[model samples]
Every structure is written in C-alpha cells, then in structure tokens.
Target chain A: MWSATDPRFGFWLPLALLCLATGFWLTDRKDSRKRLASVTLFASLALIVFFGANTRGGDTSETALLAVLLHMLGPVALMAIGSLIATFSGPTPVGPLPRGLRPLGFSMAIGGLIWIGLMLIEEPPDAIANGIGETIWGAWVEVFLSILILVATLAGAFCIMMGDERHKEAFTLTILTISAGLMFFEIMHNGSDGLEATGWYQIHWQQMVFLIGGLLGIILAFIAFIALVYMAERRAPDPDVVAPLTEEEKSVVDAVLRLNLELEEVEE
Target chain B: MSEKKDAWWGPIALLMLLIAFSMNLFVWQLSGGVEFSSIIDRMVTGFSLAFGITSFALLFVSLGAVHKHMRWQEQILGLFGCAYLGIKCYGWVGNGFDSISEDAVILLAGLTAMLAAVGLVFGLLLALVTGREHIPDLLLEMDSTDGDVAVELED
Candidate 1:
C-alpha cells in the first residue's frame, strides 16, 4: 500500500537515483578527467542506494531489490569506465599505490551487499530512537565504506600530485576539504547531542556541508586527472629524449641568449 | 648522556586520565540518578577543566617554539606530548562526563589511554631510532658554541 504519490517516499527514491545516475555518467565519460570523478561518484552511489533502499522498501519489499540492482549497476559500470579511461588515455605515470587500497574498494562492494542484506532482514531503527539497535555488523559496514572511499580518494590524489606538481597544492587542499567534511560528518554522527538538544538538528546544515564540499572536491580531482592524461599523451618518445633541440627547445635557447651573454661578461 | 627525563606533563596527563577514570567510578559508586543537574554540572566542569589545562600547555609549547632558544628536538617532543594530553582531555570532555553508563566510560577511557600510550611508545621508539643520528653530534657540540644564551621570547 505504499503510494507512489507519497512525497516522502516518492520524492527521495528517484532523487537519490538521479544523483547516482549523474555520478555514474560523469565517471563513464571518455575523458580521463571524468574518470577522476570516481570517488564522489562511487560514494554518492553507495549513499543513494542506502537511502533509497531504506525509504521505499521497509526491509522486505520489492523496492529494496530494485534499489540494490541500481546500486550494482552504477558503481560497477563506473569502475569499468574509470579503468578503461586510465588504460586508453596512454601510460600516465601515477604515484605509488596506497597500501591495501584496492582491497578496501573490493571490501566496500562486499559491505554494500551485506548492508542490503541487513536491510532486507530487519527494520531500520525508528526516527525517535535514532541509532537504537544498529548492530556492530551494520556499523562495520558504514565504517568500512567510509574508510574505503577515503583511501581511494587519497590514492587518486597521490597519482595526480606525482603526475603534475603544479596542481599539487590545489589537489591537496581539495583533499583536505573533503576529509574535513567526512570528519565533521563522523563527529556529528557519533554524537551531536548539544545541537540536537538545542534544536539545530532539524535545520540539518550538516548534509549541506557534505554535499557542497564533496562536489567541489570532485571537480578539482577531475581537473588533476585530465592533466595527468594530457601529460601522458603529449610526452616525447624515447628517441626524442636524447636528440638535440627541437623547434620548441630552440625558442627557449634564443630567449636564454641574452642571459648567456651576461654570464660570459661576468666571467671575463 | 644528558638526563632530560622530567615528564612534568606526564603527571598532568595522568591527572586528566584519572579524572576520566574516576568520574565514572564515582558516579557508579553513588547509585543512579539521585539528582541529575548537580551531577551533570560537576561532570561538565571536570571534563572542561581537563581539556583546558592540556590545551593551555600545548599552546605554550607551540608559542615557545617560535623563538630561537628552544631546540627543534624539544619542540617535536612537546608536540607529541601535547597530542597525548589533548586526546585524554578531549575524550573526557566530549563523552559528556557523567551522562553515559559508567561501564561505557570505563571502556572509553581505557581505549583513549591505550591509544595515547601507544602513540607515546611509538614516539619513544622514534626517538631511539633517530637518537643515534643526533646524539653523537649533540654530545660533541657545546651549548655555548653559539656564544650567546638567548632568553625565551616574552610572548
């Protein structure tokens, strides 16, 4: 008897799916830059899936099944799209891979399945009780997913910094902002009794903090990724490495001529 | 070979740790919820006081390092110590001193102290590893080689 016309259920379900789909498409683009959109895209999909599943289906409905299906579709497709972009964009040199990061990614996928399974089995805690009866198992799923996203983002930032030092400052600052957002969210989620008691909870600016910061981070990371691909594609061949000045190099030589003359006079 | 073993701050951190440990113990000792407000106020003050003391010390260390008189190694040591103290203080304060179950506080305090202690131990290990690199030079170098003993800044 769940009405498609019910604003609470009807609105949130497709809105969440739209966010996920948008993330999926951006990550699916041919451009290497779009592939760098991976973390936000992945995180958004996971969150959307979770929110969608919880809302429309009360643990046992066909709606939960459909939400899981969409969840699987978005992330896996994006992952494939990212790999393809990385491969086809030429041999872009990346930084050292973070320890246990790929495994974390795989673990998050497994955790997602477990989360859906849990939702299917038990009803979510009521609004008033809030975190009542959130099992250690459920908490672990959330923690694992958060950590997975963080590590993956760090790995991506590392690759961008190695490929282009100029973008390093911007990329790192973006990373810091995203990390701060996650940290703030965690702190609030852990306990925000003061805010809740003071009645600021209903305003829910916390979600805005997560969304805005995450969007900005996604944009910066995308720019850095594309820059890496550009460097990789335009890199000189091995033969060109030892060869004498090309036209581009000769222009630099002419510019340095005055400086060389000045150095000669100083030596004399 | 210089004896620089004065952990005056250790007692301070330990005091905060004890407060965190004892608050819950004392709360439980008194049987539950006789009067909530006075208990809540005392708990709040105790937690805030711990946080303030530790953070104040950290601020002093940070400020001291801006001047030339403080050695770089001392600054590093101070930072690690400050982090330890800060963790204990924040843990006590943030957990809402007396609101939760005493059993929960016990576990929380134990975890907080264990993590801080581990960090402290790791810092000691780091000191041992890098001590070899600096000790020889430090032993050979006289304090007066720079010829002027500068007083710490008045800030």
Candidate 2:
C-alpha cells in the first residue's frame, strides 16, 4: 500500500508532472512562446486535475493508468517538440528538416525511450545489491554532467555571436534535434536513480548511449554544413543583381551619411 | 580566406577544448562526499582554476560585444546585473545590515537580477559571435553594399 503520507511517492508524482510541463514550455515554438510561464499557476492547475481525478476513482488503478500514460507519452512528446524546432531551422515549402536531421531526431527520441525502459526494468524497489548499483549509476551521472556542462557552455558562446533571428532559430533547432534523446535519458535516469537510489544496470549502456548521442549531434551538424554548401551552389544569385534596400534601410543609411557629413542633401 | 579561417578557429577551438577538460575537474570537486582538506590544498595550483578564470574572461568579452550591439537592452540589463552582484557580494564578502527581513528582500531581488544577467548575457554572447552588427561605412557607396553575415552563411 503506497501511503499518501510517504514523502517518496508524494514527491515523485508532482515532479514527473513538473518535468513534463517544463519540457512542454521550454520547447522553442515557431509561432509563440510558452503560454504558461508561472510554476505556481501551473502547479495549482495540475493539483486541481489530480485531486479531481483522485476524488472520483479507483485509486490504485487510476494511479497506475497515469504512470503508464506518462511514460509512454514522454518520448513521443519529445519527438514532436524536436520536429517543431526543426521546422523553424529548415527551409519551409522546400523541406521541413535538413536531410540527415529527421532521422537523427527520431533516433534520439527512440534511444532515450529504450534506455528509460531498460533502466526501469533493471531497477526494482526490492533490489538485493544496492552498493554496486549506486556506484555505476553515480559514475553515469558524473560523466553525463561533465559532458552536458561543456556542451552548454560552448553553445552559449555561439548564441552570443549569432544575433539574427534565422541563425538563432537554427541553433535552437540544432540543439533540440541533437539533444532530445539525451535530455530524455537524463530525465529517465534521474527518475530511476531517485526512486530507490539503487539500480544495477550495465555501465556500458550509459557509455554507449552517451557515445551514440554525441556522434548523432556531430553528424547532424556535418549534414547541415553540407546542406548549406549545396544550397549556395544550387541557388547562385546573379553577380550583377545586388538586392535593393528597403525604404527603411535607405533612410537608416541616409541618416548615417548625414551624421558623418559625407553627403549633403539637395533641395527636393 | 584560409589564413583568416585559421586565425578565427585555431585559438578559440583549442581554448574551448582546454576549458572542457578543466570543467571535468570542476564537476569532480563539486560532487558528493570527498576529502575536502586535500582537495582544497590542490585548489591553489589546479589547472581548473586557471581554466575557469580564462573562460570567465572570454565570457565577459563575448558579453561585452553583446552589450555593445544590444543597445538600450544592455543598459537596462547591466543596471540589474550590477545590483545583484552588489548584494551577493555584500552577503558573501561581509556582514551586512542586522535585519533578516531586509536581507531576504535583497536575496529575492538578487535572484531575479542574476537570472536577467545570466540569460541575457548568454543569449547576447552567442548572437554577437554568430551575427553581424551594423557598422556604416560613410565613404562607401551605400547603394553597392549590403549587410554581410559575419561568419558567412554560404559556407
């Protein structure tokens, strides 16, 4: 019997929901920003639904149904989010994703789901060996954290340099495309580790996941680079036909010219 | 073009790799249950410290360019960044006012300010590195020139 008073279960159910909401909200939408920004507001709304269901239900079955639904929907939602980001990055009407990125995003989402399933199966509450399990899990966390921080810092550098909307969107898409799987793995791994703080999984699984994820990110970027090269070659603009500036730009340039006193204005 | 390419990437990539390696040490140090005394002793001569400082300096440089390009947004954010750092420094470096309520107010304000500083700086830094900031050349014929992407989009 899972007690309502038990801190572990009490803590987890809400946390899972929070992670879901955060994932949903953080997704860089092409049309609009995340509508629900306040955690308290979302938490209150979540509580209303949970309590509403709780009052009208077979408690155990209802809880189990939700758990299953959440786990199943998690990876799918991640894929959808990544695809949305991809649409923003890739050229519209022509292609929704840069050639290699579609497969890469799919792989990440599926790989994350697989890892989560394996981890859940391997980690049970009444585990016989806990120490060895913790050791491996801890190592997995340490390595993952190291890589995550390094990658984020470098990305921060790139984000600082690229101010244009299209380029910013490209970077955002690149991150989501490459990392949707790893981020899923992160969420799952932490959840399992927190559940009992004990999980005897093969350490190779962690290393293999990390390797596959890093390689996929690299491959996606490489493909995008090639796509850019091919795009330039295919759609070469005429050497003589320079684009005319818009009225706004002409005025801005004129303002600069006037400020510099390089060009005197003639009577209209 | 090749020389320019080499100059742009050579030092930056090497520095990033070095920073990445040092960050591993940072994670190791911050993580659970360790011999604190010996680790603190090694902290004096650790490569991680130097690497961390270098990264911070580079981050500042990146943010400074962002600040320059960011225009009015920079001034708005910088005022808040300075305030947060000021309050945090007061707490960290010295004992401030006697009232806990006042301290709490500063803490809350500090947190918000810190978020603004971090989020804005990181986003701006990346923007500046990737995008071209407008620099008008008065002597050049404006009709002939267009804004070029700083790191050419055409590979």
**Chain A of model 2, TM-score against the native?**
0.25
lDDT tens readout by residue for model 2, A40-84: 337745654554354321232223323333433444355444444
Residues A1-268, candidate 1: write the lDDT tens digits. Answer: 7554343344334434444344344432554434434554465456545555455433322233233334334433433333333232322244423433433433443333334333423433332113211221122222223333343344334434334333533343344335434443443344232223112121122211122232333343344334433554455344434667889989998879978999999999
Full-model lDDT, candidate 1: 0.36
Best-fitting candidate, scored by lDDT: 2
User: In model 1, which regions exceed 4 Å deviation?
Assistant: A1-34, A37-53, A56-268, B1-8, B30-155
Docking class of 2: incorrect
Worst 10 residues of 2 chain A by lDDT: A196-205
- The runs of at least 3 residues in candidate 2 whose Cα sits more than 4 Å from the true structure, single-residue gaps closed, are A1-81, A84-91, A95-142, A159-268, B31-155
lDDT of 2 at B154: 70
Q: Provide the global lDDT of candidate 2 against the true structure.
A: 0.38
**Docking class of predicted structure 1:** incorrect
The model with the greatest DockQ is 2
Write down the TM-score of every candidate: 0.20, 0.26
**Candidate 1 at residue B49, lDDT?**
34
